[model samples]
Target chain A: MALADARALVPHLPAFPHDPAGDGAMLMRAVEACERYTPMVAPDGEDALVLDLTGCFEGQGWTRETIARDALAHLARMGLGGRAAHGPTPDAALALARFGMDELADLPVAALALGAEADLALRRAGLRTIGALAARPRAPLAARFGRELPVRLARLLGEEDRRITPHRPAGAIRAERRFAEPLASVAPLLDVIEGLAQRLESVLARRGEGGRRFDVALFRTDGHVARLAVACGRPLRDPPAIRRLFSERLESLSDPLDPGFGYDMARMAVPLAERLENEQRDLACGEGGEAQPDLAPLLDRLAVRFGPDRIRRFHPRDEHLPEYAARPVPPESGPAAWPRPEPGEPPLRPLFLYDPPRPVGVVAEVPDGPPRRFVWRGKHHRVVRHEGPERIAYPWWKHPEGRGPTRDYYRVEDEMGQRFWLFRHGLYASESDHPQWYLHGLFA
Target chain B: MTDSPILRLGSRALSAPVPKGRGVIGLDVPEVDRWLKGGLRRDGLHEFYAPSGSPPGPAMALALLAGMRNCGQGRSLMWLRARGGRRKDGPHAPGLAELGIDPAALLLLELADPADLLVAGVESLRHGGAGAVVLELRGRCRALDLTASRRLALAAERSGTMALIVRGDARPVPSAAHTRWQVSAAPSRALPANAPGHPVFDLQLLRQRGGAEGLHVQLEWNREQAVFRTPIYGDPPAVPAGRAEDRRARRAA
Candidate 1:
């Protein structure tokens, strides 16, 4: 027990300081690397990892034993030793892998990961193996050893189940391919993507559905993963279109995909799916048959290159304020019908409106009459003709900041034939004695 | 006044694909028709340049766009722009409706990068699903040089989709556009002392592919008839000529 005796027993022993942070970070890298197997890999503890292989391994024609063996081999290559086991539940598998093979009956109850004090108490009671503890009467054990004893015993025997949360959400459908030799070029990778898309298309077709989003993940030989995803405006099952979208998506990536080493495996998954019904096309009328043109393709390409937010259509909002009357919504939203104008009538509003009303100096004859002259952008303009003093009151309940008397809007034409939409912010008597005028919009 | 809709269109007709082809839409004015060599060809790019310190280019662009929309039936329009341009605010729907353009038939894309806007505009032209594609770019976009303009022009020609690029407060740059015009607001014909009339524009033909250049025209938009007209034939004065001056002189007296 002396330091000299221990050193003499193992004279070549290496020692280093404890590094919990380094160990934790290494464990996280291992977890990320293991995602090549399944997206649902999670770090169980400091030394363990949990993978939910519910429906994934079966698709590859691999049994649970092979999956475990492959996982252990993978970690071994990473310079870390690991033990893996498959059970009916995560708790059961964890207990078995740490203790021994199916010989769970002979292992000590301490293998259940119970706290040290409880384990020592069970040992003092002459309960050596899990079998001895499980053989005891349920009621007496609960009363004497505590409630956790029976629960732990049941879980170890695969009677009770425990849930494990995956680090990443599992996709609805997935297809993958592993190559004997790693691929380095984009052409072959794109071919693989096409094949995977076809596979996904069949899967979607069988389910009478379509995929709205597709994610392609490449697994490098050096344990790195690069993922690219594309979204469609409508439910899509076409392989070529899906491939084209992926190509566009790959080009649009800010950080280009780099195969540091080489990619060993590639996978495609449909994370979001929607129901789509097939429709017939009119050949005679051809492209002109549809009343509203199909702009979805154009919209999708633009959205992928730029962003969905950059491309949009206007929708009517239920607001009284001029600025709030309309809002930009996604292109998928149906646009509201514009009000039609009667023949021989001047425009109701200006073609372009200033987002934030620009302030302008005004000179008026009467207290509440329309502006006779105005100064905009340090330029003077004489109002030759004026249309209205249309009063638009503020919705006090909605906007407390705009809680004032009604705004008087006038459509006026200056001497230069330039028309403007200007409004007085408040009234003379109620809100403010001297109201301010704002240049709001311009006429066509 | 003519009973035949075809007669109303006069001898100049749009390039017809079929014998009854409605391919090219005209501005219905013989002067502009002769100037444009049969109105604006549907299969090309039109550039409208509003010079610096002017407010009329945007208005003229809208009027021309309204006229272009009249050519195609049930055809939608797409307008693309950069986010931080001079007029970042989008077109008001009510205003567009008053110009005879259904806002429902329009798609507006506001992008941060001018390059993306140009690319998207060209791509939209290629699709030809929309009747026309309009790009509102202010100042100079390095990405939209002569080469990009030519590419867009070719795409529009190939697809038969009318393309219009409206540059605000920017001088004419080297472009391969089919036609280029400089537009500025001009005072309307003297009306009654205080009455307003139709909008008037002083339009100068800066460049045209195979047509005469250096031609100037004073144009007015007839809101009631929804047509473009030369100012030579003016409508009855809304207000008596010099009425405002007469009133001012009277007040002075």
Candidate 2:
């Protein structure tokens, strides 16, 4: 009449039971639900999750026993059958929850399975229940099960104690708040979010670290929940900066918590973290003050308001042709510096660059310096002073079709003092195709 | 008869009002001072037109630094868009320091974007407290003109600073400046007996107010001492009379 004998008589159960959607899938969903409490939730096996609730329990105002019971109840509510136990080691907890729940009064060595040899020794001693098994002399158990069995038994009974060290993901931080009363409305929720962000900022500042990706979760009444997530281009710890990124994400949520009954708690967690060095500006010539503005928040705002593709930065390609110089890239992903043309080259370049060089008509013949007259966009311009024939050849090695021609660029000033940077796309030297002309840029 | 003494006292007080001075040194003369004023205005825009194809020299740059250092203390002098010269190619730090300008007080902006340069200039002018702004443009000054110059001038005035635009030969006329200067290499000095002579400049005072047109002045720049002084001739040198009139006729043609 022992717990192990009872389990053995019932017959061996599969690691997971078959459901229409699969038990593994359901367990995965349940594990994801645990993220509402902490982002440090990890799957222990096919059917269980190991949650590092050390820091989380204090905020929940719950003891370890209460947390364990509540987690069992939560799983039950989700229609998942599972048992829970609070113990020092993961192995001990699993064993207790699986085979030592009944016969709480009897300290049974036989009930606990310490492999085949320990099972045989316990059978010979006629001991059952954790209480009875622990009360017996440890010397005999050590001689039978080796040193590991006794130490593990003490840990299981909460006597000799062990610690379950939780695995923390890299670049992670956390902030949380528990409300005395369920809170409703966006204003108060924002206030709580801001407070949490400030706490995270101070923590990160002390550690010289910052968070690149953050998750904000609201644990609502009746176990219903809402969450907001944001990803930044760079790691940032400034409170205002964090708020700016989150505010946009907050505005994008559909079916936003109407505080339909209010959220009982809120928390922010950093899943992917980074260390940031303090940045100091130069006092000389105010150049330090002129650094490029942080475009992350703006891009986030745009992505929230007008989809992810709305915000972009120009990235130039490695080509000599003016039209092929640049392309648009998502603002969130780009190098620190924009590319520049090689030095010591004189081709009249435009200040306000166009994406593709616009083609124009010319009346000039082959071997021409530049057109004396060209009509662009249905308007005629007479060139007065002209300079160039600065040749630019396409990279033939990369392009099999070969970029058509060697461009002859010109710096032409018109009668109205408007300077144009025009180029003939193909030269007379290349016989593969028809030569073309294009108006590349305008000089201010 | 009783009112005579009171009337005389009021008249004397009105007539004895305090007289303000003409202008600051390197800031008052025509041709030279006019450009200097724009270049040295508590906050103003000065434009320099260097010959096309010829890069700027140390002497020209040092002359600019001398004017900039007179603004005030703790003022930052920023060089926006450095062209033609590398850090080692030019006498950058020590040259400015030799002109009584603090090299540490300078900010070198190696931006390739013309728009970025303009934006920096505008920001510095708006904020003030900065000592001076020097921008070197490879092409012409068509992008920066009278209206932009005026806006910059107003900003400098509000901030109490200055803006110097150094451009190539193809630059258009700047309308907002008090004066514009075209700087070119002057003839080198002839060696004198028994003494190592310093180099002298054949400065042509081009474009000044009150029609102060002349190319007669010869300035000897003492590099060691960082001073510009008129060189003393041993005796009264022979004058080339009417050379100015001859030069005017040649320009008209």
Candidate 3:
């Protein structure tokens, strides 16, 4: 019935517009609560979550039914009403729980969920229950109501099984702690993190490896998970060092962590780890021994506080174009080297390069000549001395029909002794009607 | 002593008269090293400003100085630049390599907020592992007050690393800097074909904490030699390249 007709019939019916998007988002968040059970928790259309709890029931002595019961209990605590069921396959379990059917054989033919038309056709053919649909031959059923009717029947009847694609990949090494009395403040988080880090160190030490990146998750009672991550310059296994880095991260958060109503659980995972060899410390002559201070700690501290992208190092590339010649990367991540300059010559390149080289009005030889004078930013500079037309051709292979025009570069010095690297964009008549001049860089 | 800025009491040059405990290094110029009392103090803070109207000279000078602190010491150098410069492109790597500084070893710290530039500068200064720290504040930095400079100087003193700050479009302000200099471009000596020669700078010692100021000098940079020297004037006329030999004969007559 239309909402207007229903309103007229009832006179006063409190109603709201259907919001599928909001409902979908809320369902996904509610599904996150199942991640505490297993990482292989996946949301199955509109209102259900399918969990693949393979190998999760060992040692704890809890069966699959008990796990589902616990999940439903947690959902109830979060103010969400849900149904729990166990089946041989994800489809069977979803159909069973959604239809509130205890026995699979008693489920209606509509439980196959092959669409309303297929359901109506099957009901007209006297197949009103899933048992009746299963009793019929699959070839006739496929021929009658398309090929998907039989497959949906098989999956809904626990004959076909496939794994669920997990919402998140489980970490290789992780530690979690649950408290009976939820922690109400953020003061002891570092201590808790240090304790977790110590647990992770033993496993890493045995494997002869260390963690380079760590992620911590705080599970709140209100179903909100707060996550923090930090990366290190080197593979680190020391608990105190890891704690220190996290302390810096915690202090620099734009919005401080809020343990709304308290956090009930905390977990730490080493998402990325690398091999690290043992080191020997020399007790004697420790001061000024090699005279090199360890800079990794300080760099990691700064990187955490300000951010990794803020600290960068230049990596020069082998390219014909000046703009692509160099790039900045995170600190110490580049090949630390540079080519030696040509001897017995003034520096050809300017100290600073202007991107989209600034345009200038110039007066020079008509055919092809070095600029005699040029006006840049409305200021005139008379070129007292200059070196030519170091012609650089554009990279032809980079374009389909051949791209940009050749540039004629010049290193010119103005009367004030200021040096500039400018260029003519193209040849006078062949490439363009009139070539344009541009200032590329400034020389100190 | 004469009233001229650089006092040549005798022909022989004197070593910098530094205090008993402190160490100093030279820029390979005798007059400049002497005028600077000893030379730049190892654990000190120095400031370099671009001349009022000039734009490009001081940055290159500071890069050359940073190269001095980078090479032969086996220690990496840290350079901090704020992200809010008016210019689009950053320091050209090939240009830095041409000026004798290794682009790879120079760690570039780009701060998103100009306010964080000083904090990063002071942190890098206190790290003690770096050979030197160069802070590039392109314009007037309101955060770098006397107190902040003092904090940077103290950090530099604690760790034996040097601090150099380069300002692009800024006026001289009161700070805790040991030596302050102004740098601007001068005419380069012409080469064989009237081409611009090595970079020459007209530098002035604007102020020194405990020494003299207003000492002006024209110095040229030699990248291969990794030193600064008195600029040499070329004999060839800056122009008349095409009528060269005939003009020389006429001038000789």
Give the candidate number with the greatest lDDT: 3
| Between candidates 1 and 2, the DockQ winner | 1
| Candidate 2 lDDT tens digits, A173-211 | 788887888797777776787889999998888889888
lDDT (Cα, tens digit) per residue for candidate 2, span B1-253: 1112111122332344333322333522233333233323445566666555433442245335444554454455656663333321222333233334444445455443565456557665665545676766657655576677777767766765677776654544635654345544332222221111233333333443333333234444554344555556453233223434432233234
lDDT of 1 at B252: 30
Model 1 CAPRI rating: acceptable
Check candidate 1 and list the clashing pairs: B191-B239, B192-B239, B192-B240
Alpha-carbon lDDT, every model: 0.74, 0.56, 0.79
lDDT of 2 at B155: 72
Return the lDDT, model 3, position A234.
91
Per-prediction interface RMSD in Å? 5.6, 17.6, 5.1
Locate the minimum summed-lDDT window of 10 residues in model 2 chain A. Answer: A339-348
TM-score, prediction 2: 0.46
- Fnat scores for every prediction: 0.55, 0.00, 0.78
Check candidate 3 and list the clashing pairs.
Answer: A417-B187, B16-B38
Docking class of 2: incorrect
